[model samples]
Target: MALQILLQLIVTGLAWGSVYALIALGFVLIFKATDIFNFAQPELMMLGAYLSFTLITALKLPFLPAFLVTLVLMTVISSLLEMMVIRPLVGEPVLAVIMVTLGLANVIRGMTGLIWGYEELQFPKPFSAQPIMLFGAAINQAEIFTILATALLLVVFFIFFKYSRAGLSMRATAEDTSTAFLMGINVKRVFTASWAIASVVATIAGVLLATFTYLEPIMGHAGLKALPALILGGMDSVVGAILGGLIIGVAENLAGFYLEQYLGGGINEITAYVIVLIVMMVRPYGLFGTKEIERV
Candidate 1:
């Protein structure tokens, strides 16, 4: 019985962790390309969810159509954001760029509230709620879908980053912006692509999460929770992001299951941060993060 409960928690954790991983990937991708830590990422995730909800509920579009449309719209929106807001800040101090992102986050959050309202809204479920037994643990179809969708998306990302011409250009640019431009790589296009891709990834995560529960502006907080995963995996490593998310997810669930009873509520909420703190004390740069040295 104990083992069954543990398995159940692990499976559920992986599902939520996948969402965190996707969110973390968005953060890492843009940071790698532009060295800009986008504070608006969570709000972008929130915006995706709200836009998806509006498409389905207001426009009466089916789930598949709504999902694709949301992706297209977010890609354009993200590109515009990069061009209009971030492009002007080029060559500015990193602190200035970061502050702009913080301001952008508030603007996105406020706009979402004004448009979607603060009330929780029901999201159409893409999968049935019926629980199926997996290795003696019951798992919901929605959880299964979340995990599978994450896997598929990761595969697609791998292919894109590994084989696509644009992907190679982005990689080259990320490694050295000046050299990339000297080599004739279009750095400006790569920046737009990175933002668009990050937004699309965030949207997918947002829509998947909405399938599991009521959609509310507060759901963007999940992006904040993903910070530990981002830090734990190393901010620049994609594989680390995925692994860190899974670890945090499973650890939080296990902690909540076992420790919450003794500690009296909310242990799960703090578990990810606590674990990251301990890990960083030892690794400093994260388990898989690259170490950088600068000469005076």
Candidate 2:
């Protein structure tokens, strides 16, 4: 019984963690590109999910078509936001930019509630809710799809960042924007591209989460939940986001199961933060993050 429950938790946690990893990836990408820790990412996740729901449920579109369209729409929105809001604020103080992101988050949140209503709604289930038997453990079908899709995106990004010209441009810009511009790269375009990429990732994560849980404006909270994953994985590492997400997910599940029995409920909610504190104490650079050397 114990072993079975443990396996169940692991599978479930991985699915949930994939969502966290994807959202965290958005945070990392934006931060790498612009050095801004976007607090609006989770709201973007919520917005993405709502967008999917609008395309499928309201517009009566097929799942695949809705999904594709949502990605495109998110990409456009993200780019436009970068051009209008982010670009204008370029060279501004970091604190001022952060305030913009925070304000943007609230604006997105209010817009979501205003458009979709404050009520919770059921999201379209793209996959069957059946559980498949794997090594005598029943794994959720949606979860299987979730992890597979996440892995596929990760692979795509790996190849993209490694081999593509635009990828090189992004890396160069991330390393040093002025230098990249000096080398003839369009730094503004790169920032827009980064936001578009993050938006697509957010759309996928939002869909996965909508599948995992019900749809609601409140679902955007998952974005905020991803911060700990970024901290755990290193704020700038892509693979670190995935690793941190899985670790946080599994730890949260385990804590909820075992620790809850002793500490009551809600330990899962705080488990990732706890891990962040403990891990930082031992490795301030995070599990996969590069430590910065500052000179006086």
Candidate 3:
């Protein structure tokens, strides 16, 4: 109830929210471009974390170098999947695409287990260990960096999708793939670009998350946590993803903190779903989702 405690909680929420937003953004980007709910995204995130960890720990690479390498590698992998597997499946049944992505997720997860082994590993502490104080609340340097990095990425994405040619093509394709193709937008290329962008964001999210939680092949389940955010924000709205993520993140922190005293513990695990249920009751199409209309 103290003002400082509330501030500290909010800072924590923002950090976690940034992570969720990045993860959810990946989902929204892919779905917007391809209408494919990439169930493999979580696994891709896990792969990002593992690859970065390996580069830094095993190869003795510097943090910046390793992070950059991981980003490029993951982008290539995601782009390849889109070009090889997803591109070929275009115009197929929606369920089939969903199932294939889910299968690919499992395949990635299994591969990660074989390579990384089934253990929780720590990412190297590359950020400063010192905690910065703001308004009588202490925040870790890593947390500060995470917030800044997330914000910077969001801004860059806003500019990209707003001003860049590729971003415009993505928007056009999302609006109407056939129309975009007719206009010479290269819809297939848009799909591949979206996946590459999603992979980059997921890798960034994964690296940040590894700083907070122990990294394991199963850690990719973090995507499940972001799904409700994706729904709450509007599956097709990128900005909605950002808003939804913050709301869910803050709600989880506040509810977990206060409710733990009453629920015995771990209520945060279901907070996103609870929020989703409540939000859907009020706005079935989600806060920013487009509603369909039909004339009979």
Candidate 4:
């Protein structure tokens, strides 16, 4: 019984962690490319899930088509947001940009509530409902699919960043926007593309989350949970985001499974924040972030 419970917790943690990681990746991606900390990522995820629900449930669109349409819509919205709001704020202080993101997050949350109402809504599963057996342990098919999908997306993203021309431009812009511009790269376009990609990732994460838990307005707050992963993985490291996410997910699950019995209440949610605090205190630059020296 003990072993079984432990395995169950591990599986649950990985599943939830992957979702958190996906959210964190959005933050990391935008931050890496544009140095903007987008607090609206979770809301973007919420928007994606709601959009999916609307297309499938209300508009009566087919599942695959709805999913594709949601992706395209999210990409467009992200690009527009960058061009309209974020672009104007270029060269602003980090705090200023972050504040804008925070405000945008709230705006999105409110709009989502207004459009979809406050009630929790279910999203249809894109995979089998049955749990799959793995090495004597049973895991939900949806969870497995989520993990696989995230991994695949991450790999595809990695390849794009490594080899694609647009990806190269993004990396150039990220390293030094002024230099990238001097080198003929369109820095503004890169920023817009970064946000668009982040939006797409957020949408996929939201959809997967809705598969596991019912969709709600507050679901965008999942971005808060992913913050620790961003910090741990380093603000500029994509792979670091993945690693940070897995760590947070595993730690939260273990904490909830082992410590919750003694401490009581929901420790998993609190665990990520605690981890972030500890990481910031110890390694301020994060695990993979470049060290910066402050002059006076």
Residue-by-residue lDDT tens digits, candidate 3, 146-205: 888999999999899899998888899999988998889977788999999999999999
- What's the lDDT for residue 67 in model 2? 93
How well is each residue in 77-177 modelled by candidate 2, as lDDT tens digits?
98998889888998899999999999999999999999999998889898887888877788888888888999999999999999999999999999999
lDDT of 2: 0.90
What is candidate 3's local distance difference test score?
A: 0.89
| Model 2 poorest ten-residue lDDT run | 216-225
**lDDT of each candidate versus the true structure:** 0.91, 0.90, 0.89, 0.88
TM-score for each of the candidates: 0.97, 0.97, 0.97, 0.95
10 residues in a row with least lDDT, candidate 4: 1-10
Quick one: ranking by lDDT, best first? 1, 2, 3, 4
Ranking by TM-score: 1, 2, 3, 4
Off by over 4 Å in 2: none
| Candidates 3 and 4 compared by lDDT, better number | 3
Per-prediction tally of clashes: 0, 1, 0, 0
Candidate 3 local Cα displacement, residue 270, angstroms: 1.2
